[model samples]
Target: MMAQPLLCEVLIDPERAKGLSLQQWDLLIRQARHADLLARLAYLLEGQSGVPTAAQRHLDSAWTFAQRQAQSVRYEVASIQKALSDLGIPVVLLKGAAYIMAGLPAAPGRLLSDIDILVPKPCLERVENGLLLYGWRTTHHDEYDQTYYRQWMHEIPPMKHGVRGTVIDVHHAILPPTARLKPDSSKMLVAAVALAAEPGVCVFSPVDMVLHSATHLFHEGELEHGLRDLVDLDALLRHFGDQSGFWEQLVERAVALDLVRPLYYALRYTAQMVATPIPPFVVKALDKLGRPSALISSLMDCLFARALRPSHVSCDSQWTALARWMLYIRSHYLRMPFHLLFPHLIRKAVKKRQGSGSLTEPIVVKE
Candidate 1:
């Protein structure tokens, strides 16, 4: 086994990587790639003399690949904008697309698997029809699956372009209609900022952008890329934290949007795991917004700490799987009431056991 420093710590101070052997560097690269941070790692190591020549080559290759992929994603976004322009719908870019369009620090060296956009619920049908007319087709064809997405889910069924095979997720809201936290999607749309570079594209406001990222990371059952998501949070904080009054506005916006808890968790974990620089007074103010009790927080700390690490075999432990499962259950519970959740879980389990292809599970594409 190779001795490894914490990846986040190494990213913060690449000089600390001076003494790592080629084999250890190989391990680090593999772990970083698995966590979808390879290109970001490459970006951080640029111009650093401490990295081995061979390792530097690998990082450069990763960086090249990321740049090419980002370019392709931009093309796709342009096509989507054209597809929806006739409808005159306000297309709000979400997640990776938003990061790229806004030219955030989180954008460069970030690998995007698919594009995500949001439109008003009333305009969803028109947007969907326009996409299909422009050669995009629903990845899910089953009636049950289609109904499930339309009735309960926040987004329409995933669609892929017929010729290019590029996937896209079109969301009408950030959370499911059945979710416990009913964030006002209209307000989010109203507050969105237009991208100067992209005429038809808009992105969430600075504060809402962070809130949505936190909500996506914490609310989802998947932990495979939790650490990468944390890295994104760290980058967003470091980049935006520089502006005067940013922290206060973030806290205030979170409160206005009823997203204080997710912001609290985002701050707590990023500070704990990656040493993200959060202000003392900001933390103090958010602490008053009803953080989880000490016992629950401690338990969450253990689960998240284990789950957020790279999912490499060398890092695996018996407790990690249990922690992931617990968080998975907790995520669904948070999203839906027990009455709806129990039946949903049972149906999913039965479908998995039966090996049915009719109902495909939602795929979380990284970017």
Candidate 2:
């Protein structure tokens, strides 16, 4: 049996690419694409010699496309900040935009489909209107989706640029108002680090960035980009893990934010899959603080072991589909109690039955 996907092996040790056959490179590229890590692979393998000419061409192309996309993100974010600058509220960039603006290690080779930002909850309406006046319009025109986002979910309906086709998600919080864990958005906002390069723009502190990435991936209904997100966590950790007191700050911050579980899963999976260098003391700290029940822990190990693999034929067993499905259901369950989740499931089921189903949530999962 294949113990790990070739892409994962290459990720942990880019030198593995030095000896691969062209046929193996073909398979690796396909798997990396499926996992949304093709460009990331290119970035990691850069400067490494012995890549076949054909493979090098594809990697170069992927990296170039990613670079172009990253540049576009910068322009779009500037427009977004300018749109809301008059409102006088600090605009907190989230996810990809944040990574790019903050110059985090996760920014390079990342593909961003939309721009996300967080503002104070009280400024939600004003921020929405501010973007509206700048020619950004809300998407998810369906009434149910509008309500689902405005009422329960983390952010407002996704807003897109009429001329540029850029999408922006403005948020008051990371997780939904209805979610099980209630991390204090106010606390996070206070700790947000202002970007020196982009005045009036800020990102979560290093600890919060890692915690939010973990929470988003583990709580998401879709696992299509699971491996990609895990890679982001790996980058964030490796980068931040260097600062003095970073490991202790991570533990304390997770406790303060009530995000220990997601942090635990992030650290464990990144270590398992990417060979992310996590210290033993940090693992021991979380093991006591956030470890699940024995039965649940074993089940999670089984499920994520399968679900976190590259979603490709060569990388998975027949059980992979089942694992993804179960994790999807589990994500919904984790976010909301049965009472709330059941109705949403039924509504979505009816839509699927009618053959016009669309997820109420945005394509990119919110916290």
Instruction: Score each candidate by Cα lDDT.
Output: 0.84, 0.88
Q: Residues 1-367, candidate 1: write the lDDT tens digits.
A: 2233357667667676678888888888887877778898998878877787778887898898888878878888888988998987689998877888788999888876778898999999999999999899999887878988888889999999998888899999988878777778888888899888778789988888888999888888988888888888888999989989889999998888778888998999888777799999999998898488999988998898888877776566778899899999988998888997898799889877887565434434333
How does candidate 2 fare on TM-score? 0.95
Candidate 2, residue 94: how far the Cα is off, in Å: 1.3
- Give each model a TM-score: 0.93, 0.95
Weakest lDDT window of 10 consecutive positions for candidate 2? 358-367
Clashing residue pairs found in predicted model 1: 111-367, 112-367
The local distance difference test score of model 1 is: 0.84
On a 0 to 100 scale, what is the lDDT of residue 25 in model 2? 98
